[model samples]
Target: MELTAALRGQTIQNRVREVGINPNHWYPVAWAHQLPPGRVIPVVVWQQSIAVYRDTAGQVHAIEDACPHKGVELHLGEVHGDRLVCPYHGWEFDRSGQCVHIPYFPPDQKLPCATALSYPAQERYGIIWVFPGDPQLADSRPILEVPEYDDHNCLMIPITGVFNAHFSICNENTMDVFHGFLHKDLQGWFDPVLLNLQDSNSSVQANYRVSYKGTLSKFLGLSTNSDGVTTRNVSVHYQYPHYHSTMEGVSSLYLMRLPVGPNQTRSFSLLFLPKVRLPKWLLRAIKPVLVPLVLRFIFMPFLEQDVGMMESEQRTYQKDAKRRYVEVNPAIIALQRLILRQYEQFMQQSSQSNPANPASQPPFESWQDQSSNSSIEPLTVPHSGKGQ
Candidate 1:
């Protein structure tokens, strides 16, 4: 549904900082290239620990990280053909997580019914993804499509971000374009105005008009003149556990989030930029060297600043869980609502299916109170002539 693009004070939902992820979506665990054939690596989705391994046949599979027999971490084991052999006892498990062999067992003996839970796993866009929810829902949910993944003409740079914050906090940083004030020194966009807003049960989309001026802005095609301001529209779309944002034909970002735990988050992002005007062959030749240079110089600085802010926010939130703050961006409010809604929906479905499982209940009681508190001081927006 459409939401007004107005900037007005709203109480920041303290509960948003306490909510957990809806794991029904696919989450990136690692870059596919990082896990070679015959290697096993450990990963986590929400709190589900998984061991992902690539077999000699080059197929990827994921199973519970612990060995069923002795509770040893399976990642410490080695891959033998299509099976993962536990390093401690040589117990072998297949892709389906069933114990297929125990080397010391008699030739005709029956093996114990030892099985570790396995998850649906696959690869797309050079990333390994694992489904940590209902197995039946895996096939129905599709990974976010990126048309630019195959567009060789665009310069694509893969970036990894680790933030000491909740996924919701990391997400808010992406949706809150007004935070450009934090990046003003880096020639970031300013004078922001939310042009459009759309919110749904699973997604939030926001378009913002922002102005930029500086030599860096000119070189990035964000400004026509180095000294004059240039205005452009940026669209940010949050689809449950992932994000895709674009800057008016100049750049596109596909960010896949990994909620490792409540206090930690990781992102695998593919940033695509228009190729510099040059001969096709030369562009291709320099791309190897150019991608790293662009990442180290241009993108890292912006990310570093963002990381600092996000981590600081998390530290403060951790110190005082119930401290109330004020937010003016409708887009951020919409984003927070979507995050809470998705998690609640997941919990509801889980409760209906397994009513007796207390694990299906909401993680905390405080975030459930949506009503405003009268005792706390409302955060006051600073009147610094900057967009709030």
Candidate 2:
């Protein structure tokens, strides 16, 4: 549904910060290059720990991190041929997570009915993706597309962000373009006006008209002159588990969010910018050096500032879980609603599938019954003109 672009104060729900991920989507666990052939690495999606490894033949597989026998971490073990070997007692598990052999067992003896849970995994766009939810749903849900991954004319910089904050907080940072005030020293865009906003069962899209000036703006093709202001439209789209944002033809960002747990989140982002006015061949030849330079000198500074604010928000939220806050951006409210709704949907489906056990649903009491008479005192945005 389309939402009004007008900024209006709305009560913030603490439940948005308390909700968990749906886990029905594919999440990027690690960079594809991190696990070369014959190597294994440990990764976590939500709270589930997984061991991801590449077989000698170059196929990626993901299985429960714990060995079924003695409960040892499978990542500490080695890969033998296409199977993962348990460090303790040399138990061998195939890609299907079935225990096929025990080193000391007799050749004619039947193996125990031991099997570790395995997850659907694949490699794409230099990312190792794992499906942590219902395996049956894996085939239906496709990974987010990134056309720029194969575009040679764009200088693609892979950025890794480790934030000590909830996925919701990290996501809000991406959708809140007004926070550009935080990067003003870096010549980030300012004078923002929300142009469009849309929300769906699983996504939130927001567009803003923002102005920029200074040398950084000229270097990024945003302005013709260093001293002149340039206005551009920036669009941010949050499609459940991932994000894709773009600024006209200047840049594109595809962020794959990994919610490790309630208190931590990681992002695997591919930032693509138009290559400098140089030969494609020359750009390709110098990409090895150029990518890191841009990542360090240009991106990291901005990321560091974002991380600081995100972590601070988390820390403050932690101190007072029920502290009410006011949010002016309708886009942020839409995003929060989507987050809460997705989690509720996932839990409801899980409850239906296993009615006896019944997954616990989030307590959205205050959020569901929000009104002016609520007891929680709402904190308004500070008027100090400081970057919040």
Candidate 3:
């Protein structure tokens, strides 16, 4: 649905900071190259710990981190051919998590029926993805499409971000274009005005008109004249578990989020820039030097600043859960609503699937009652300036 792009004060929903992710979607765990054949690594989706391993055949498999027999972490085990061998008892499990062999078992006796819970796993776009929810939905729910992954013309730079904040806080930081002032010294965009906003049950898209100037702007092809200001539209799309944002036609960023827990979030992002027109051979030759230079000089500074702000916000929220804060961005408000809705929907589906399971009940149920009202009293900030 379409939303007004008015910057009006709205009471922030504190529950958004505590909500859990709807796990039906595919989540990125590790870089494809990081988990080579015969390597096992542990990854967490939301709060569910998973053990992902690549077999000798180069196929990836994801199983519950805990071994069913003794509850030892499966990631600590070894990979032997197509089976994952538990460290403690030497129990061997296949890709489907079925216990196929137990070294200590006698040849005459049949092996006991034991299996570790397994998840659907795949490798795409140089990243390893796992389906942490219902296996039935894995094929239907697709990973985010990245056309630039194989496009030789675009310079693809992979970035990793580990934030000490909730996924909601980290997500809002990306959707917020008005915070450009934080990176002003770094020649970031300025004078950001929300141009349009749209939201749905699982997505939020915000467009903003932002002005850029200085040498960094020229380097990014944002402006031909370094000293003169150039205005452009930045479109940010928050599609459930991931994000895709574009700076007109100059660049595109696909940020895939992994909600590790309530207090931590990880992002695997691929940034594509169209400024370089060099041949594939030359581009590949200079990629090693160029990737680090761009990351250090252009991206890391902005990410560091964002991380500081997000962590600070989380700390403040943790200190006083009921503390009220006012938000001026309507897009942020919409994002909060969408997040809540997705979590609630997931809870509802889970409850219906297993009605007897009390653990399936939604967390922060009181927030649903309070948020039903269209508006709440806005809290006033002391400074009322750019920093707020």
Over 34-53, each residue of candidate 1 has an lDDT whose tens digit, in order, gives 99999999998887889999
Stretches > 4 Å off in candidate 1: 223-227, 358-362, 365-388
lDDT of each: 0.87, 0.87, 0.88
Those runs of model 2 whose alpha carbons end farther than 4 Å from true positions after fitting are 225-227, 360-388
Instruction: Sort every candidate by lDDT, greatest first.
Output: 3, 2, 1
Under the 3 Å rule for N, CA and C atoms, how many clashes does model 1 have? Answer: 0
**Candidate 2 per-residue lDDT over residues 1-388, each given as its tens digit:** 8887776667877788888889889999999989999999999988899999999999999999999998999999999999999998899999989999998999999999999999999999999999998899999998999988888899899999999999999999999988887887777777788889998898999998877777676667665444487788999999998999999768899999999988999999999998366679998999999889978987899999999999999999999998999877888888888898888888878878998976543444434624423333433333224221
Judged by whole-model lDDT over C-alpha atoms, candidate 3 comes out at 0.88
Q: What residue runs in model 3 are displaced by over 4 Å at the alpha carbon?
A: 225-227, 277-281, 358-362, 366-388
Query: RMSD of candidate 1 to the true fold?
Result: 3.2
Query: What is the Å distance of residue 309 in model 3 from its true position?
Result: 0.5
Higher-ranked by lDDT: 1 or 3: 3
* TM-score attained by model 2: 0.93
Q: Return the TM-score for each candidate structure.
A: 0.93, 0.93, 0.93
- Which ten residues in a row are the worst by lDDT in model 1? 379-388
> In angstroms, how far off is 276's CA in candidate 3?
2.6
Error of 2 at 361 (Å): 8.5
Tell me model 2's lDDT, rounded to 2 decimals.
0.87
